[model samples]
Target: MASPGAAAAPRRGHSPLLLAAALLLALAPSPTTAAGRGVARECTYTLRVKTSCASPAARTSDAVAVAFGDAYRNEAHAARLPTTSGSRALERCGTDTFRLSGP
Candidate 1:
């Protein structure tokens, strides 16, 4: 029988296993890992005629193009200017700025 007030023996190799698990967890991918996936980014478009447009948060560059087209069309309509085609607007309105950030 164990003596009263005697300390229990340390478990064999338990600490190492715990430490390895901790390391694995630390090295594992996080819930917010980007992993080359696209994130919401802001992009500005500038047209040849000095018309400027800003897009809403977009996940990919292609999405930015679509957003730009929509914004440009609305702005042009409001300004009583002719709306350009999506491809034409994209070609004319070169990207002024594009910034990437994590989710």
Candidate 2:
């Protein structure tokens, strides 16, 4: 009992929920593979730390220490980042590069 000129709603094979689920699955990160089992791999990280020079005491005499790792307990530690060479600081703002390897 509808008008003849009225348009019919379109049907799609992919529903909104199905499309959303597919998109999420596509964007998900892939799990790590075991291809290199027992083999050691190294990871290098370059960290750059900057301090605000606006303050009169922008520089610090204390040493800077860094520690980082993954959730699985794999970690790297540095007792102190080399900020100075002899009496003079290498640079107020500089980059520290380091590498860590593990099996």
Candidate 3:
């Protein structure tokens, strides 16, 4: 027989599994977030003139250069320019002027 005035046992803390799951969720990266940790898409800048551009793909410089050539051609056509010519490089985004090559 049980005692009539006995107290109940204390509640236990959260389970280890639950805690681990929660920690994993908190540390997981969100798919919707933009990835800018490494190299980011930057606009190309030339001799104090900035142009809309992107860098060549890693380990595929030739292919990327060719792709950028097409892009530049399209841009020129849209701008009603006769032709476009320049070198590929990394530059800041949203910049309008091309930066000088050296100091």
TM-score of each: 0.16, 0.45, 0.12
Q: Pick the candidate with the highest lDDT.
A: 2
Model 1 Cα displacement at 91 (Å)?
23
Candidate structures ordered by lDDT, highest first: 2, 1, 3
Candidate 3 deviant stretches above 4 angstroms: 1-36, 48-103
lDDT of 3 by residue, 4-97 (tens): 8987654455221111001111122235444555532233323222333232222111211111122323221112111233533323222222
Q: Which candidate leads the pack in TM-score? A: 2
Give per-residue CA lDDT, model 1, range 1-103, as digits (tens): 7899998875563212111001011122345545456543232232322222322222112222211233323221112223334434222223322221111
lDDT of each: 0.28, 0.42, 0.25
RMSD of each: 25.8, 19.9, 24.9
RMSD of 1: 25.8
- Backbone clashes in candidate 2 total 0
Global lDDT of model 2: 0.42
| 1 or 3, greater by lDDT | 1
Q: After superposition, how far is residue 102 of candidate 3 from its true place, in Å?
A: 16
